[model samples]
Target: MIPVFVGMMYGATLGGNATLIGSAANIVAAGVCANEGRPVTFARFLRYGLPITLCQLAVTAAYVMVLSKFLR
Candidate 1:
């Protein structure tokens, strides 16, 4: 249950960085969560979101670097 909850939060929050619609959806989801008593504050969301976003950026950068090197 905990894992599922985390996954959902990550999907609704971190997943927003992918697109405009996603960003809007995450905001709405956050509001809903707050109303339900979960209260996903900016700081709390950042705590989890930042690291994941950084990791994703790192991986994507590495993949592009590798491809560029090989293709060059």
Candidate 2:
């Protein structure tokens, strides 16, 4: 239960970085970029964000599973 809950929260938080609007930090970065006249558009973010988010989530999920195995 604990590992699952932690994994869910961990995955969610990290997954939030997968988009310009997925997180506060991302939004802030987008705002900064916009101020610099280089706004992070949805398509622009998707190009990089999707892969990174998917990779991170995969890794995190694997880690959680391994940890649960050892812990249990």
Candidate 3:
């Protein structure tokens, strides 16, 4: 259950980075975690989120480039 919750939070926060309004879910998730006694500070989230987001974006871009090459 803990692993599931962590994974959900990770995905939610990652998706939340897509837009300003979407970030509400990230705040809400952090609040929930705090209430559950596992507080996730903004800095902590940013520390992990930023790198993960960058990596994901990089991978996605690479995939598109490869796909375009194949299609062309």
* lDDT of every model, 2 decimals: 0.63, 0.88, 0.66
lDDT of 1 by residue, 1-72 (tens): 444444455555545664323477668878899899987767777677677776775665566556556655
Off by over 4 Å in 1: 1-22
**Residues 1-72 of candidate 2: C-alpha lDDT, one tens digit per residue:** 979898989888988888778889888888899999987898899899999889988998999999998888
Question: Quick one: best lDDT, which candidate?
Answer: 2
Tell me each candidate's TM-score.
0.61, 0.89, 0.59
- Cα-based lDDT at residue 13, candidate 2: 94
Q: Which 10-residue span in candidate 2 carries the lowest summed lDDT?
A: 14-23
lDDT of prediction 2:
0.88
lDDT of each residue in 1-72, candidate 3, tens digit only: 544454455566566664423577777888889999998876778777777687776665566556656655
TM-score of 3: 0.59
Candidate 2 clash figure, as a count: 0
